[model samples]
Target: ISLIKKEIETFISSYNKSLQQKDKNIKISDIKIQKNTLSLNINSQGIFRPHNALLQLKNSISKEFGKKHKLGVREIKINNYDIQFDLEKKPLKNVTIPFADVKFKEKQATISLNNIDEEFLQKNYIDRMINLVNEKVENQYYEGKGEFWKLIWESGEKKPIWTKDPTEEMTKLDWLKQGPTKGKWFFRPQATAILKTMEKIAVEEVLKPLRFQEIIESNLVPFDIWLKTGHLEGMPGEFYYISEPATRDVEKWERFVDLIKITKEVPLEELEKNISTPAAGICYAQCPVIYWSFKGKTISEKSLPVLVYDNTAVSGRYESGGRHGIERVDEFHR
Candidate 1:
């Protein structure tokens, strides 16, 4: 793992020198390696074009590693790429609808629009739309089996509380105000319902007609199992041990820590010596990831490079006060 890290560092150093010659002030912010794949997260400054920079980086990496290794760029931020929406012409007392002006730099487009009363719509129609969408999704996709879809409820086990200790008492509403938990309860229900409706439409309406196989469900597995499979780790957020029972085996814990140290450059030696002490919750997990092309049965040379995807929630201990609505959470479902 360290050797891989050193190779990546060396590649970046060489790439930076090349970029310097081209008068570009950009560098990689982070690098995530899993198996033979490398994901480079870049940070750019001063008129950097993401598409062009990515092409250059890919070329450099190809020159260094050849075709044996896979490389990708993640989270490329382009400066000053802004879009503006505006009303082109005002409506004359409901006689005519206004036109919307969509502008992106020198490019511009216009479209017809209708302005609706938000308060009246919310008071009269929002609930009805929500119910209709929910009903459609429940019957069509879930076959009216609501049990399969868990509602975000006030579970005392997962609630966010104000107290430093878990034993301390707090009101449900008070706990919600602490972070994005409020959004999970208030907004996620409607958002998830709408999302499910779209997904159902795509699968049933679109993909089924095209005869594509539908694998439209999530998997629930143990945390250790997820770690062992190398599905999630080492991008962001702090590590957390949910329960002693889940992580009580000292030998297994040490092995997991050492694996992370090798892959993620974490200081496992210090962490192992101070096992009983907390270290700002920075520890992460490392697992051996089986590539999609190699999963299950062996394939012939003619059937090469199969695609696979794994989507599920994974646990993390995020820094306190880092929560932003449902965008960032302790357990992210993606």
Candidate 2:
């Protein structure tokens, strides 16, 4: 019994080390040992499904004791009482991923200002041009990119009858590197009585921080931000981009900081049964460990998207079935 206990201790030590390496918040809190029965308790910062962890434990026990008890006579009970994830927001830094879009509007209103002795007409025309420019800019933002047009007025006037230098807010054009145009101009004279302006800048910035916030908040997509460790069974984003063979390969992981929709949870039991299938292969090992049981019960699920199995992504683990998790030391007790 002592030898078996020592063996178990060694294995436990290694297992605990791997879990720690993954930064899994779970820890071995209690252990009950006996001749044929053993129970291990762990605390974690929440899991997608507690039962998945239970199943992994079950498999580990069976695999460990299979040499002597092929029938899988070992039982396991893993409890996660109060697990909380430290999902605090980080500092805001500039990112090149174009998370936001910028739209700038420029207006150039030009009139001959010749043979016209009226100021209201000129003012009205300039105002109208400004409105036109604003309209064009707003439309472009919604309708994609277009020419950053300009309207210039020229006449017999020595200085080419001009209105107040319209463009006041000179947005460092370079700042908007992705902008459609850096400049545009048009020159004409009908002697309407209005004047022209050099440049009038109107810009709008749209930033999408919680891209997935709308879906979750409106319940349009049933998804949650898992700041801890676990798996997301089903997400609506899966259907957006389908894959060959099945949906597993097509499914994309929308992480804790992603925006997604919760469609349903994938049947983990079915996945376990068919570990060799292509779909399973895609979704398998999604996390270092899966949470399946909540207080020792099961729930009917449909789909899953995000999985938190590993805090660190290893180069290659699938080809070895986590053999890296095991180390055989030269120590035998018989």
Candidate 3:
């Protein structure tokens, strides 16, 4: 069965040969497998067919093996990449009922792959190519400027009943002459971080249709991309992400502008230790900065707040054709 899936991939690649002839430069990369399933996305392809092409491949597998299976479901966005699949295996003896032989009911699609002969469709439809590629699509978007989202500060200050042991001995000094530079700690409530974080990588959706589509579309793989911006307590929401991208990876940034490259993942601990301590010999405690480390990504303050470091990751793919995506540990994490 695994071999069949791989073959389905080879078959799809072979099938896509005609796409290039049409002057369509569709590219597919990234291949993944999970128990009884496989998935990927699409990028750069003029035609969106990962979901559709794979189903045909799956249907072919079903016909040759006398097995019953069905197509998977998918969600497509601007790039048109999505998730798609087939039904689980079951015994043919269950065909005794009217809706008996149906292997699975995915998204309300009554699909039967293996036993339904193509010859039958031709016999009934008068030589017409009878294939049903169906999917439901919805458009949901948020309003913003050039950057999909924005982060702004609100008037959230530290609660009057502050809890964390804070410093407060108003040091009366001539430094007040510097005005804003004086140590005036305005207890800030967690302000929203603007699309502060992003993870790059080769397109994972490459696996989505690679197993079944003759022509894999999409040259880029995008997953769990994180976007954080500044926000205030009671102000109009400051930040929102179109997609809940996973954690960030440092390796991916070693080279941006490239998307097809692959990189090895390092332990969150190793990533943390690699930080080249203050080239200027300054710590957050001494410079009115923020110092913290958790999960993997670390933020060491200097003049401005910076990520400084990140650890958890999957594969860092980028859009530049060489490197991409951040290293992600879990679909959601630090």
lDDT of 1: 0.44
Ranking by lDDT: 1, 2, 3
Per-residue C-alpha lDDT of model 1 across residues 1-334, encoded as one tens digit per residue: 3446778778777776676677566666466666655556554554553335656676676676655455433323322222122222332212211122222222222222233332423343433333333333333444445565668876467655654532122223233233344213232354556556876786678766765542322222334444445444433245554322334667857766776768887665645554453322222321222232244777888865433323332334454666554455554443
Q: All models: lDDT?
A: 0.44, 0.34, 0.31
Location of the lowest summed lDDT over 10 successive residues in candidate 1: 91-100
TM-score of 3: 0.19
lDDT tens readout by residue for model 3, 1-76: 3545766567456645544465365544454455555444333345544444444545554564454334332322
TM-score of 1: 0.24
Better model by lDDT, 1 or 2?
Answer: 1
lDDT (C-alpha) at residue 2 in model 3: 52
Instruction: Kindly give the stretch of ten consecutive residues in candidate 3 with the minimal lDDT sum.
Output: 281-290
> Model 3 Cα displacement at 159 (Å)?
74
**Top candidate, metric lDDT:** 1
lDDT of 2 by residue, 171-285 (tens): 2322112113112112123211122121111111211221211110110111222113322332222211112332343232222112223426564443444233322112222
Candidate 1: where is the Cα deviation over 4 Å? 1-189, 201-297, 301-322
